[model samples]
Target: MSFSSFDRKKENSPQPSQWKLLRQELLKYLECFLMAVINGCQVSAPPNRTAAMWEDFITCLKHQDLVSSAALETQSCYLLTKTAVSRPLFLILDDNFYYQSMRYEVYQLARKYSLGFCQLFLDCSLETCLQRNGQRPQALPAETIHLMEGKIEKPNPEKNAWEHNSLIIPSTTCSSEASLKLTDLLLTALENPVTYIEDNVEQKKADRIICSTNVLHQADQMLRRIVSQTMKEAKDEQVLPFNLKLLAEELNKLKAEFLEDLKHGNKKYLCSQETVHIPDIISFFHYEKDNIVRKYFSKPH
Candidate 1:
């Protein structure tokens, strides 16, 4: 019988078998996923120095909040532009913070003056954030003066040496991926053994968060690539850096403690390479193609 034959006023009218076959075909593409485990949860800044920065920056903002929005915008503008600000003002925002606003503000300010390269580093920040503001570095600690040059897709060995330095936004996120970034001995040394062990438990759970997280990251990357590619092919000036970077930032957004642990390098995760057997999606859903629509109502989305 045709689907139109269903009785009038019947929301649960029988569905055509063809509709079920189409529905099952759609589910196949949605199941594939990827995953990675991690260990450690270290922040770029040492705990002591980071705490101090938090205290001081909050105090600075408190004064601005006391004034009206119009007045504050004037002050924020002066701080952002007019005054000859010193090199490298670190703006730290946690995963919970909506930092796209910060990015837009910085991008706008950069337009007026050649601010060198504009960069957003996830997982890591510049080294100076940990250093005392006035004291000179002992032996000129390595600085972020240039981009990690070379091909965008291939590995570049000379990345550490490129000169003609300008704006280096060194981020801990782009460095050593997977287990490499987490569990630095420096951070482990700072931890009290008992609390450290407890943190490890939550970290495992994070690593276990269903493949949904990875799916979201992959979707975002795919969208970014399509966007970047479309823009670049037409010679557009502004093409966003997509892929690992876009994925990295979203990964940091997972509210799960494991993600936080992975971001800051607190909880250590075991990383072992393994092969996968994707679900028998097609066969499983197509058990009986003739009556597929019946299965659609019986099964879940």
Candidate 2:
């Protein structure tokens, strides 16, 4: 049957206690999205020798182009069929899947199969990751961790178009808490998959605001450094007629020019979106400038 017809049938079908049903159904399929980490950063390994050996074999085979390609195709078909027979469940693959750029193709598969796709990155510092690797029974080489660190591309919701539902879990997060958080995020993503595009736009807007704020802060710091250095040089040289009033006027002129330059340079980003208040940003700078003037210029030289 066509997807549209199937969707129509689904829409017409009676679903009692939809949320409860969904939650229970999802719990059953949770294993689908619980991807294993084979990047030498796993905090624990399976105690079973056979399981560990199998995992190691899979990891090694994944490095071979022909084997990996065949494996991915087989896995995709299995996942697609499983999803078709039941509610959409998370498909958890290893980090190596993302490194190989197969995650994008998987994402496409999810869309084609009408499955919800989200990526959860278990974020850990290099030191922490390496330390964890050391604790494993079959410890991976430090060089392996280093190689994966350089090769693995972390998912970004704002930048990666396919990673609209991506989330980063910090190393400090407890397992239970992380599981709960992942479940919540996945449920939300599944329920609102169509909104991913809109969510991405909002994410970009937030990113732009943060970048602009950082630029303003850097500019303020630059101004303070310049003023302080100029005053110190003047004091050392014993320049005549150098006073607070003269310094204030010079600093004000510099601030005005800097503000003008900022306004002109970031006109596109600043003016394009009305999400951020330009006046509020300007006021913050004004307050900072006044504070700097009061603190430094008030002192007798």
Candidate 3:
């Protein structure tokens, strides 16, 4: 139930049966691929050290107070299951999830309803929740630590290796790159006390002269550079759910209005409109900077 090169059949007109079969196969691939990766994270490998890795992991997660424990667990499982990375969806979802905040009630609600209306129902009415996960129990000081002081038996490496292999799953290459970036950033931040995240504000690189974060509307004004990039890429690839022709038609109408305004001295009206040109003035660079182009027409279309 996978698409192959052979399926790119000539299309004078696709028969209804053919369309149905193609859609079914696509649905199966989406479901199987999604489930395989999501399910892969319930890894069975016991940590090499006798101590519970979840304790250390949970401790590390707390510093990222940006994320909730339960949500983090879900994302961790997603990554574990999606052992091998490859696909555009991986970047979109993985990136979005990385920025999410998690909660224990989110987990409880998930169990109670299994995400049926978590977003539409439960989460819609929810206000920001802050739960103080108390400090992690400190491990005995490093100076007195012993490798195997506890009479605990060592974990089975053979079993772990088997589970590791069994746990390996395929994903888009971009997923691996993104995962590594996130991991490296977190690791670097933990390893260095002075590390500061670039302000999420809409400051262009050059605009960040002194790394001043005192800009007017700080947190609420934070720009999503990731979403912006995703949108640009999606537009370039024609993957956005948009009606291009309709959009162009609308723009042309807008341009006509702008032209009419410009014909007179309408410069005092709106700052945005002052620089606008005829809708047909600019051609589409897959529709990325149409608004910008409207402002400054560099060699009209």
Candidate 4:
């Protein structure tokens, strides 16, 4: 019943530009699936490599052109469509997701849709990660592991109020106690979907930007920081060594694009208040970076 055989790591995962679309379609599919479960559909056993009760769900996604016809025949598709005989459905997204912005994207989705959101941080020591990596048939470069060690941003619940539902456990811990705690975590998340909370920090940032004498200078500085942070995040996520140069080129390209849009007064890039918001541009830059990552590199090296 394990989905290990058909995880997203082996598939052409969604690109950044498609992320919003994917999230919307997934929400729709979840609603259909929940309705089906409530209607007492003939659910399959352990839901392993079967999609008998998921026709409606699959059709819903297919009609949106999210999954191709060929993809439907794959084990990954079946795994995605598989359902539990319970009320709540959990769709697990497994990845390195090294950047906070990357994880924040998912958090925003959960908040917007009022879905459950929780983070499980596996605090595996660098030594352990390197050891296990060495044992693998296709071990990643030691340097890559070292790079990730320095770049990984552990869950900081205190710093981030929204991350209050996070749990951190040692990677090696596999006791019944851990399992029970995990079960509780999931239950708690399912019971309490994330609610929209005003971000005072963001509000303050916007106010400062608005009142600044040199708004363009402030924006340029922020954009530079965004680029620098994005490059670091890319490295932290262990982008394939061969694609690092391409990733950089792509990021710079996006920066130029944004600069042009800002300079020439692109209406789409302008806010309703008739002023350019650096945060919006930065967010769009991250989205572009995600697209570049998915297009150039499937997974971390």
Best by lDDT: 4
TM-scores, all models, native as reference? 0.17, 0.36, 0.15, 0.47
Of 1 and 4, the candidate ahead on lDDT is: 4
lDDT of 2 by residue, 130-241 (tens): 9999998768689978987876777766656657687788967888978888888789768865333446675465556445545665666666665676567556545545
The CA root-mean-square deviation of candidate 3, after full C-alpha superposition on the true structure, stands at 25.1
**Model 4 pairs in collision:** none
Tell me how many clashing residue pairs each candidate has: 14, 0, 12, 0
For residues 126-148, could you state the per-residue lDDT of candidate 4 as single tens digits?
99999999999868789989998
RMSD of 4: 14.3
lDDT over C-alpha atoms for residue 144 of model 1: 19
Q: How accurate is candidate 3 locally (lDDT)?
A: 0.31
lDDT of every model, 2 decimals = 0.28, 0.51, 0.31, 0.62
What is the TM-score ranking, best to worst? Answer: 4, 2, 1, 3
| Per-residue lDDT of candidate 3, residues 152-215 (tens digit) | 2222225222111111112223477656655554444334322123234522322332122222
Encode model 1's per-residue lDDT on 1-301: one tens digit a residue: 0011112123453354453333222122111100000111111112232243333332333343311223443223112221112223222222211222323332323222323212323323234433432364333223411122210222112331111121233343345543343333213322312121325554344343324344333434443443344334323323235533443343233223333333343333212313111122122222322132232223212
